[model samples]
Target: MTSEPTHAEASQTGTLRGSIGVAGIVFLVIAAAAPLTAIGGALPVMIATGNGAGAPMAYIVAGVVLLVFSVGYAAMSRHMVDTGAFYSYVHKGLGRSMGLGAAALALLTYTAIQAAVYGLAASTLRDLVVEYGGPDIDWWAWALGLIAIVAVLGYRSIDLGAKVLAVLLVLEVGIILALSVAVFARGGAAGIDVVSFTPASFFSGSPGIALMFAIASFIGFEATAIYGEEARNPKRTVPIATYVAVIVIGVVYAVSSWAVVLAYGSADVAAAATADTAGLTFGAAALFMGDTASDIMLIMLVTSLFASLLAFHNAISRYVFALARQGVGPRSLARTHTRHGSPHRGSLFQTLSAVIVVGAFAIAGSDPVLELFTWMSGLATVSILVLMILTGVAIVAFFARSDVDKRWWHTRIAPVLGCIGLIVITGLVVDNFALLVGGSSVLATLLLVLVVLVFIAGVLISKLSAGKEVDRSEHEESRT
Candidate 1:
């Protein structure tokens, strides 16, 4: 038998360099969640159109479900360390065809979400510029410019991107937490309503939609495992990072959202949100803190979106690299930069794809926030939930046949419970798909159909690609 490749050899070729610690990985994962963007953007929408005052409860419920999912997910990370993450886990348990399908869905999930964020980020930036007396410009121009900057950052060493994200994450999260504290300290609008957590309120006004949006906010937390290969001592680092990131995201979102409800009082919050969905969070900041605090939050919102774009860019590029390395994509995409040790080819590919998608939306004169962000983000939310369910099942299957670390909680119980919860959430998403995508049933149906077709196409590609299984086996062995 031939000798295994050295660390240096692997780094110079197929394997990503290990440079990040647990904190770095956590930064990347949490930054992708974009606390400010989720609170200031998605939270108001959830309050207005979802479960209203009970919106905070929805976030708590979503967090608990994902925490259970992460138990088994972290266990799996101890055994396998690869950038493929969900694709590799599903492949190990469900077989190559299902693995490829999961991979394709993941690609769609990340790509579409990134594009969605770009739409919002571009629009937000355009508005900010005009508010500050800058020259008027199209949203697409701002989007393209942001994409170019992300491309440069993504094309560099992974640590550089992590550092940038760490700073942005700290600032946005700090402002949000500060705002939440101020609201509570001032006794809020109605003395901190605990009724928001009541079952009656929680189940009111379409809880399914509320849950869907809450869960969507947690999308980027699973990305912890995606950075495993680049993490120092991944077996330890990945698991710790995963748990920490999940808890932090869940807490930040839940507390901040609850604070927003307190700022407006539980009774009138929904109406206020409906009246001014875009400005609801800003208004809360202005009321609880000061006008200066609100202005700072507006600036932080842009940075939060920028940080999210960079995080997702890194994630999508790595997925492309992983697939290419597995012989499921172009081999060139597998190549890393010799100097930067980053997935340069994959980064360039993702950049171009974003440009093309955004260009098409612009040329068609689609509304960035309404059409591009809503539809694409809605599609991503559903697709990712489905992937999570599949991954939970795959974890159970993989552990059933293997003797490695046979803890029942980590290997079976948690995964099964998480799977069941995910199934329910997925069903909810499907039931409210039209509402999630701006009340367009036709568009919702088409998007759902597209998800199914993309998965089927992936399965077909796996069968058609010669030597794919062999390539996957060798790749896994090398990493192990």
Candidate 2:
């Protein structure tokens, strides 16, 4: 008779295979953040609705917080290795139960963010087509088409994702850089101004809101560890990529937002942003490099959204694979492609979820940007902030008893401080949740409850499943 496969043997079926270097991982993380999307889509909102001229300063401060978080995070990555990432680290530091809970939270967060981008991409693509005198296609039609494309790519080799992201990221960042350089070269409506970097400007408007947007832009920086299994020399590559991504994203965001302030006088930026909330960046591009540049920026904006969608799709698929491998989800989900070594099953599941979400919103006749993008993305930001705080605490817990590396600062001091900072940020997110989701306190509360319940459900299912297996083994022993 054939022997049944052990759990450990069975779990090896869908292992990821890649030798992605730091540059490759960085490309994926930065592409997920989508520099152009942040600049053209989120920056003007930050300027008009958040901290006005002080928005750039908020990016600097947010960057500092993440860099500090990286200190403990990088250290943890060295010792604890798993693609489950946040969940795996939490398991090593905390307990398996808490780790499973974290896995559920991570899945929720990534799924929501991916769906949010689909909504944004669909709407943006629809407008882009209509602007050029194409037929008025429904946003859902575009969203469905893009989902099919992403599904195909995400089910392939990890290197394919990296290569595609690298190309899209370069073009998007290049266009934004060109626009920023033009803004600085032409001087301001007034003269060149450094007011955006000043303390007074930093405190001038709703800095809390600005900080929220700035932190949101750093969404994928923590995902370096999610690809740990695929990364070549993961310990070194993960840390380097994490640090580089944070600093690069921070500098680019601050510089670009500052240049926007300079293009319009610092004193007048809020008014300008308000007047043309949707077209402010394009208007600046038109003024500096002519209508042709503005057109190019608009087209790149669509591609930028597509790049982000693909990046997040891959992230969510990996999370699913990690969970299924550990028996937290369907066993079939853990199986990888024989030739490509891709988590094809998980990719399909994630695509199906996206379809359901996008379809539901479309059927309800909700405004894609307002209802789908803002609400879902805002919920994801809040969920991720909670995970960050938990992971920081887990790092401290992990090191308090062990003496493996023996670096007090990395294990203790930095982790403690990072946890505190993230805690404060979480509180801010909670307090401003209504504002983040466009003043729907009820919806914000519902999302928070949903996240909590999902976590609890995961923990209970794991515990119950373990208990059942133990009981069955005991019964067999009694029979023998």
lDDT of each: 0.92, 0.87
Regions of candidate 1 where Cα sits further than 4 Å from its true position: 1-12, 466-480
TM-score of each: 0.95, 0.96
lDDT of each residue in 1-480, candidate 1, tens digit only: 999977655665588875899999999988899989999999999999998999999989999999999999999999999898999999998998999999999999999999999999999999999999998899999999999999999999999999999989889999999999999999899897798899999999989989989999988887899988888899999999999998889899999999999999999999999999999999999998899999999988999999999999999999999999997768889988878888899999999999988899999999999999999999999899988888999999999999997899999999999999999999999999999899989999999999999989888998878466678889999999
* Candidate 2 error regions (>4 Å): 1-14
Clashes of each: 0, 0
